[model samples]
Structure formats: structure tokens, C-alpha cells
Target: MYSIVDIETTGNGIKGNRITEISIFKTNGYEVIDEFTSLVNPECEIPYFITGLTGIDNDMVRNAPKLDEIAHKILEITADTIFVAHSVNFDYNVIKNEFQQIGLDFVRKKLCTVRLSRKLIPGYNSYSLGKLCSAIGIPLKDRHRARGDAHATMLLFHKLLRTPNADKVFKSFLNAKSQEATLPPSLPKAEFEKLPTTPGVYYFKDSKGKIIYVGKAINIKKRVLSHFYDKSTKEVTLCSETSYLDYEETGSELIALLQESAEIKRHYPKFNRAQKRQVQQYAIFSYEDRNGILHLAFNKLKMAPNPLHIFYSITECRLFLESLCETFELCPKYCHLQENVESCSHYKIKQCIGICSDLSYTKEYNERVVTAIESLEETKTDYVIKTKGRTIDEEAFVLTRRNIYVGYGFVSKETSLTHLDDFENYLIRQQSTLEAQRILESFIRKKEPKILKFTAETTR
Candidate 1:
């Protein structure tokens, strides 16, 4: 038994949405055994746009029965039946939420005519109720009304029941383990199933093969599945338009982060918002205190005079400063990590060396501060960072020329790479980006990287 259901809502989304009108057709496979249709007073003013699309105005449902008044009838009619609808999740979730608000539980085994039609009927330009019905010659009347759409969905479901191999398809979709009911109607199961559970960057593409969003994950399959389950409006819309998926596995998470940023910039995917915003620039600078202690600190680029090193985010600035503090054996308090404190008791930096307590020589500390600042302004030498590759037999290396990121490449472990010039043959060159720099610096700050130096003569 299946109850074909549809509802016109006062709002577009599941949460806080109230049903303005509802229609249900109780069917035993081939024929309708019972039916129910009613206008519902949602107890809220319907938005102008919703009224425009649905044609159900405040006047129409003003005197109609409230949902709580007819809740018992709904429960009785849908009892012992599987719920069916076009783009079923919307209708099913809206109704389920309505029931919950009235202190009732509505749970039913669900089926989507759109998903089923795509699987059983095969090639069609669209699976939306109106388009699919018109394409198949199903007479659809009173376009957006609950009864009209629900009736059409029932007829479509009847055709799907008779299509070849539909029994098997229906069985698979009904299985408790199936994600068929959760995925967007336009996306194919195969596209999602092929995703690898490895570290990588994934792309969500529309039907026309344009990249719409890019993301990196330690487990690509798990992360992509999370998007499907998200109920946020933006996430739901992005998933609805995603008809395909593409990915590239980078064994190292650091490499994945770099590649993900590069792809986002190159494609400028519409759904990628975080990387599109302008990055804030920070600079490390030095100053002398009342006690003649040379302190290293960071500020916004415009505020810092004679800046030592620039970074994209405050995190990068702090990380670079912390590294200098630990290396120079300088006081964290003097470095401005802990402001206005009498002495340094930093949790991360315990290498104060008594400078905060005035035991160390001011001249010696000033000299080390000079050395740290000079290191920051020194010219970047050509180098290579080697890490794990996509496959076991290969290794990956990121190249830089004079401290500017060149690109990354993979090489066979059997091939000996002695210098930065040796990686040129395998180099897949890329443009330097602020995001890439931040990611690289963060990785270097935490990990002891395999840094290989190259001289000019080696390349010649």
C-alpha cells in the first residue's frame, strides 16, 4: 500500500514551514482505494512569493481547519502505507515536521517518484514533476495545487511500477541501507559510489560539467556524504544542482589543502565562499621597550613600520613569531605573546631563558632579535619539500624558486632526486597564491619537513 502525498507550504524550507494545503491518494499499487484533500490554516501569513507560486492566498485558507484539528485524520489515512511523492523528501519532511509540532510522530517508509522514474524510465532532460509528467504525456491539471500534483505523482508511480526491472530497482531503493532516498534526484548513484575514501580534493559539478564547488577532505567519501545529509538551504541547493562528481587523491593532507585552494582559484566555483573573500594581510615587526628589551610583534600590514615578514592571517603571524621565540630562546612576554604580564608563563613557549625576569643580557637579546629580523628579510633560496604521493610506488615534492611556490609533482621512489633542479622534469607548475602560502607555512611550522636545497650551477 502506498499513499501518494503532496503539500503546499507557507514557507519553502522544512523547518518552521506550515502546510497551507494537502492532498493524499491512498493506492493499492494499481488503483486508488481512498483519498483526502483539504485547505489548512497555517496560523501565519503566507509570503507573497509562496502565494504567487501556489495560488493559495491568506483568504483561501483563512477559514480552513488548522493542522491540529485534522491530525487524527491524517494519522488514520496514512497508517500502514508507504509514502510516495514527487521529490518526496520535501513533501515527506514538511508533513513530518508539521506532525511533530502538533505533538504527534509521523514516520513512514518513503519512495520518490522522481528518483524512481530516473532509474526505471532512464534518459530524460529533467525529473521535476511538471517536466517529467509532460514528457510522458501524463495529464497534469491545476499545476501547483496539492491535489493536482499528488494525482499526477500517483499516475507516474503507476507507470514506474510497470517499467522493466522496476521490481528490482524498487527493492533496492526500499532497502534500509540504501542512500537512494537521501541523494539529490539529479545526481546518479554511480557518481557518488565511485568516490574514493582517501585524502583528496573533490569537485561538485552541474549537468553542463561546470565546477560549482571544491573541497578537500581526509576521507573524501565520508565528507561528500555529509553534504548530502546537510539540511541548510545553501547546501541543499548546491546538492540539487550537482549532477556529477570529480576528485584527485593527494596522499598527504597538506598537498590536498594546496591543491584544493588552487582548484578553487582556477575554477572560481560559485559555491566556494570562504576562499573568495579577500585575505587580511599581517606583518611581523620589532620595537624596543622601556627596559631596552627588543620585542618582536605582529600587526596589520598598514600599522607595521619596516615590516619584517608578511603573512595572510593572524594565525600565520603568531606561528612565525612563536618559531622565532623558540629558536632565539627569547621571552614570550617580551615578544608580546602575553601582553602586560610581569613574566612569561606561556603554555606553548617555555623557552623564555629568563629574559622576562631580567637575568639575560639586554645586548645579547637585542642581537638575537636582529638576527631573527634579518632572517625574515633574507632572500628565499630555491628548495624542495618532499612528502607522500598518491600511490605507494611514487613520492610527491613541492618546488619553490627564490621562496616563491612553483608547483608540485610526483616521481617514482626509484628515481633519485638530489636537488630542487632534479624535480623540474616532474614538476607540474602552479601559480603562487596567498592561500597556498598560508597552508605551506602552517605545515612547515608543525612538521619537520624534508627541505632540499638547489644551487644555480646544478640547473645549468
Candidate 2:
């Protein structure tokens, strides 16, 4: 049995948002068994944008039951039945968060009709409820609201059940169940319904609830679907043995990367590729003299907190620092690249800035050194680094602050530190690893990103 559900919420997020309306249809095979529907008092204003989409407003739901008032009825109707929904995660998470607020833990197996439809009926251009139904002859009476969409999805699911390959499709659906042998099991339809489309990390666990694999993706829903996109030998084997999937949403790709790194270290899932336990080895140091003249050198090191640029290995660290030194015209002797010579080897070749032997104003060369240092100090302040967004084909940005790796978030332009406090509150402190630092440095070297100054600075 399945309790196919859909909900319209005040916002997309689960933490602070509220549901405005909901619909549930309990089904057995192709027939409806029971139904429940409500317009909820979300306890907040619904944005004008959302109001236009769902035709639900604060005034309309002001007198309606708070989620707490009707949550028990929902549980009773949905009890012992699998949950089903379109683009399931939004619906599932919104409901779960609401139940959680009421001191109740609402857990259930879920199945996504979108996934089932993709496997059973391929070649549709869009999997969205309206588009899929339109392309496949399933009429949609309502586009964005709950009851209209839920009823339409139920009909589409019913049609899938009537196909010749229905048994195989159902079998795949069953296998999607997180806990196949658990007691009082709800249908597997709910879990699939709640998976989000945002970039984040996901965990896959086996029957005994041991995490087997952890992964990050630009699009969590698409990535999870891709694993089941085709039943290759590898996926087929993994699918039959898999029992549960869980995920944490990271607002930006940089945050995703940081969280993925931390999680991989913490869980050490069986299928994960082991990361190096040792700290990075590349060292950036200089050979200097009593006259305050400096020369740069690169080497692999077993020590900490010594500097020119630190990397994981001698080769990468050397190549990177060498390129910078060459670009900035620093002398070899000042960088500690050579010994006992009054003039750098580069001086003979005209590659050096001649600061070693030339009695040019000390102030000018020192200015260049300062500029170079400033150029290398990428994490010293707040800035946005642009790249391909979550969709890979679109553009996005990763935000940072004060030589610290703050969490990444998205905005169309280099958003100002108009609200640094917001950024500070949300920033996830990540390890300043050589790889991540280099990635930021490379971008800054080329674009010299516009720094957005904020009066206030805080750490996340």
C-alpha cells in the first residue's frame, strides 16, 4: 500500500519554512483506498512569489490548522503505508521537519514515480510532473498546488502499474526500499519523493545500517538517480544489497567539498577511496641574509608552519612557486634558490629583477615584494570566485573570507558584503589545504576578484 502525498510550503528550505497545504491519497494497486487533505497555517507569511504560484496566501491559511494540530491525523492515515510523491524530497523533508517540531519522528520508506517512470518509460524530455504527464497523456488539472498535482501523479503511477513490464518495474521499486525486512514497514515510495536537487553529500548504507559509501554531487537528486539510471553489473549488484540512503544539503559547491572531506574522514565508509592521513609535505621557504635580501626555494618537508608556498609534494609546490617567482621577477639569491653568489643565476640570464647586485632603491623592490605577498594572500579577505554552477553548464561563485576558507554560496554577481554577518553566520570553516588554497590562488592570479568589504567580520 502507498500513501501518495504532496505539500506546498512557505519556502523551499526545511529548517525554517512551513507547509501551506498538503494532500494524501492512500492506494492499493490501481485503486484509491483512502484520502486526506488540508490547508495548513504555516505560522508565517508566504512570499508573494510563492502566493502567485500556489494561490495560497497568509490570510487564506491563517485560520487553518497548524501542522501540529493535524500531524496525528496524517500519521494515522499514512501509517503502515509507503509514501509516494513527485520530486519527493521537498515534500518529504518539509513534512519531516514539521513532525520533528512537534516532538514526533516521522519515518517511512518512499518511492518516486519519476524514477519509476524513467525506468519503465524512457525518452521523455522532462520528468517534471506536468511535462511528463503532458508528454505521456496523463492530464494535470493543477500545476503547482498540492491536491491537483497529487491526484495527477497518482493516475500516472496507476498507468505505470498497468504496463506489460509492470512486474519488473515494481520489483525495481521494491528494491529501492531502504529496509526490505523491517517491521511495520511503510511503502518505499516516500524516501524517493524527498531527495533534493541541490549540491550536497549522500550516504548509502546496508541492511545493518552501516554506511557503505559516501559521495558528493552538484545535484543530489540527479546523482542518486544516475546510480540507478542503468542496471549495469555494478549497479545491479549494489542495488540489491543497499538498504538506506541519507543526505545533508550544502548550499554551495565549496561547502559540499569541505563537508565531503570531513565526512569521508569521519565515516570511512567501506567503498570510499582512502584519503592521505599525513599532512601535506610541500614547503615554501627562502634562503635569506643579514642584509634582509631573500631568495625563494621549494622542497618536500616533514615539518609544519614554515613557509613560501606549501603543497603536498616537492614537484607541485616547486612548479607553482617557481611560476610565481618568475612572474613577479624576484631574484634567485633572495629566494634561496642558489648559494654564495652576489648575483642571482637569473641575473646572468637577464631573468632576475637585478635586486641582488643592483643598488636600485630598496623601497621599489620592497614594494614589489609586498605586492607579491598581497597577491598570494588570497584568503585574507572576503571575495567571490566564479565557476560553473551546480548544473556544470551554468555559472556560479564560491565565497570566502579573511584568508580563511569560508563556505561557498551562490549569487549572480559579486555580491557585496552588504551583509557580512549573514555570510559569517553560515560560513563553514574548512581546512586550508594546499589543494583548495591553490585553486583559489590560481583564480585570483588571473581575475583579481573584486573584494567586497564588510565592516563586520565573524567566523562560522
Candidate 3:
């Protein structure tokens, strides 16, 4: 059973808006069993522009009964039926909000004709109620009015039921539980339920399909639900604007992090504040002094030419340099930790080998610095990091050449990734950035994936 519904609102269906008119048709996929239509007195003035579009002005509904008067009829007609509409969210949410104001919980399983048409009909240029009805030879009268649109949607639903294999699809939709208990009011419960509990990046989109936030998680479903569970003002605002969710599964958490960082840089989503800025703000560089001794130093990124490692913050750069100094007995003064001192505090404490005082030969001290620099640098060779794919039988890999990220892709177990041509054919090349380099290097240091080295001979 389905209740085909339509609503005409005074403004965008947010908090301030009100439904001025509504229509509902009770159907069992073939014919209407009952019907209800009403003009709602919103208790607020309708804007002139909305009146022009919907043909419902304040004067027309001034004496009409308010939503509370007809709320019972609306519920009775839609009872035990899946809510159906052209854009189900708009119609469903408008009515739901009205019922909430009257101290009633309006929850119903929903089916969107727009989604169904996209799947069942296919090849339509537009799915708007008017355009779709016209293309499919359904005569639509009194366009923009609630009853007219609801009737048209009902006809479209009937036609969709006739599509081959649509009964099985409809049965699946009917059996699925409503996700309203856990999801935000604006997002579709069906869409939220479809999210995978896999490692990947997810995007939250507004009603217009514009991405508002990008996030990565080991479990995409759990991480996304966390946002809704949060009570912070920003999280509430994000949920309010979000109407849809989209995701990409990365088999490895390292790839997921890299992709999330790249997407945040590229999209600069309104909700993602930290990662929107350039990540490579600081870097560590090695230089030769007048005495021909190698010294490691940290500086702002633009000042460094070909840095050995990149970092997002000066503090992280300093911390890494301090660790390297402790590990290799390098002079703190050379690493910019102690400025304008003949000998650093490390030497006084016997932690340094007196490189700052020239007590250690420049040749010997420089050798340790060279080793530290090499340790921080990524392998300057072409290779791939192989990992699990989206499925068990498939394999995923990230390709890099000369310490630059090429891209990532997947292949079945039967296929061999042995040559340059294989990589070119399978890989989806991404722009190599400093952030990508840092993510790849950090992951390699921690996880150490099985690296497949490539060369010219292998390509042939």
C-alpha cells in the first residue's frame, strides 16, 4: 500500500516555512482506495513569490482550517501505507513537521518515485513531476497545485509497478525498516541504512547535491552516525542541511586518510575547517655548511628547497627534529633548537657529540646527519602498496614512482599487476601533492606494505 502525497509550501521547507496546501491518495499500486486534499491556513502570511508559483495566496487559505484541523484525516488516509511522493523528503518532512507541532509523531516508511523512476524507467531527461509525466504520456492537469501533482505521482507509481522486476524491488523497499529512529530528520532513512561499515571516505550533501562535509573512517557507517549523535551546534547545523550521503570504500585506512585529505583540499567543504588549508606549512631540510658538514634544519615550507620531510605545523617539525637529534646525537644548535650559542645545552649534558664545539670531526658528524636525512626520506623508487580490495577475491594497490603518489585501483586475483601498462590501464591517476607524500611516507613507516618494485625491464 502507498499514500501518494504532495505539498505546496510558503518557502523553502526549513524551520520558518509552512505547508499551505496538501493532498494524499491512498493506493494499492493499481487504483486509489481513498483520497484527501485540503488548503491549510499556516497562521503566517505567504510570500508573494510563493503565491505566484503555487497559486496559493494568504487570502485563499485565510478562512480554511489549520493543519491541526485536518491532521487526523491526513494520518488516517496514510495509515499502514508507504509514503510516496515525487521528492519524498520535502512532502514527508513538511507534513512531519506540522504533526510534530501538534504533539504527534508522524513516522512512516517512504518510497520516492524519483528514485524509483531513475531505476525502473531510466533514460528520462528530467524527473520533475511535470516533465516526467509529460515524457511518459501521463496527462497532468492543474500543475503546481497539491492534488494535481499527487495524482500525477500516483499515476507514475502505477506505471513503475508495471516495469519488469519492479515487484521484487518494491517488496525489498517495503520490507526495509524505517531508519528515522537513528538518522537525522532531513536525510533519507533508506539512504543512511545503505552506508557500508568499511574503511573509506564519506561526503555529506545538501538537498542540491553540494558536498558540505568530507570525512574518513575505519567504519564509514559508525563514523557518519556519530555526527548525528553529537549535540554540538555545528553538528546539528550540518545535519540540518544534509539530505543525502555518498561514500567511496578504500580497502586500507592509509588510502582512506590520503583520499580524505586530498578531497578536503580539493572541495574545501564548508564544515571541514582544519584540512581546508595547505598541509605542507613546515618542512625539514638538509644543507652543507661552510666546513662541508651536513646539518638538518626546520623552516617554513616556502623557504625550503626540496625538503626531506613535510609537516603541517612548526611544532610537529620541531618535535621531529628533536627526536632525530636524540636518535643521531646531532647538535641542537644546528637543528635551530638553541640559537646564538657556541655549544648547545645538549653538549653540556653530554647528549650531543660536541658537533656544536667542533670537538667531533665535521666529517664524522656529517655522516650521522646524512644517515638521519636518508632515514626520513621516502624510498626514491617506483613501487606499489598492495592491500585488500572492496571484496575478498580482489586486491587494491596504491602506485608511486620516485616517491610521488600516482593513484590507486583494484584488480581481481586472477589478474597480475606486473607491468607499466597494467598500472596505466587500472590506476586512476591523482595529482601528486605534498600531503599525499606525507601520508604515503607515514603509512609506509608504520604498516610497511609489501612493495612491488617496477622498472623498464619489467614493463617489456
Which of the numbered candidates is closest to the native, going by highest lDDT? 1
Which RMSD does model 1 reach against the true structure? 8.1
lDDT of 3 by residue, 94-135 (tens): 677778888999999887787677667777766778988989
Please tell me which model should have the higher TM-score, number 2 or number 3: 3
Q: Write the per-residue lDDT of candidate 1 for residues 18-79, one digit (tens) a residue.
A: 99999999999999999999999999999999989999999999999999999888888899
The TM-score, computed over Cα atoms with residue i paired to residue i, of candidate 2 is 0.45
List the candidates' TM-scores in order: 0.76, 0.45, 0.54
| Model 1: CA > 4 A from native | 278-382, 447-460
Return the top candidate by TM-score. 1
Residue 387 miss distance in model 1 (angstroms): 2.3
lDDT of each: 0.87, 0.68, 0.82
Better of 1 and 2 by lDDT: 1
Candidate 2 per-residue lDDT over residues 223-340, each given as its tens digit: 8766654334344335434556789876555556666766776677766665525455767665445665554566666553356455676667756765666777776566555668
- Model 2, residue 249: C-alpha shift (Å): 25
How many Å off is the CA of 98 in candidate 1?
3.4
- Give stretches of model 3 more than 4 Å off: 10-17, 27-34, 43-64, 80-82, 161-169, 176-197, 202-215, 220-249, 267-274, 279-300, 306-460
In the order shown, what is each candidate's alpha-carbon RMSD?
Answer: 8.1, 19.4, 8.7
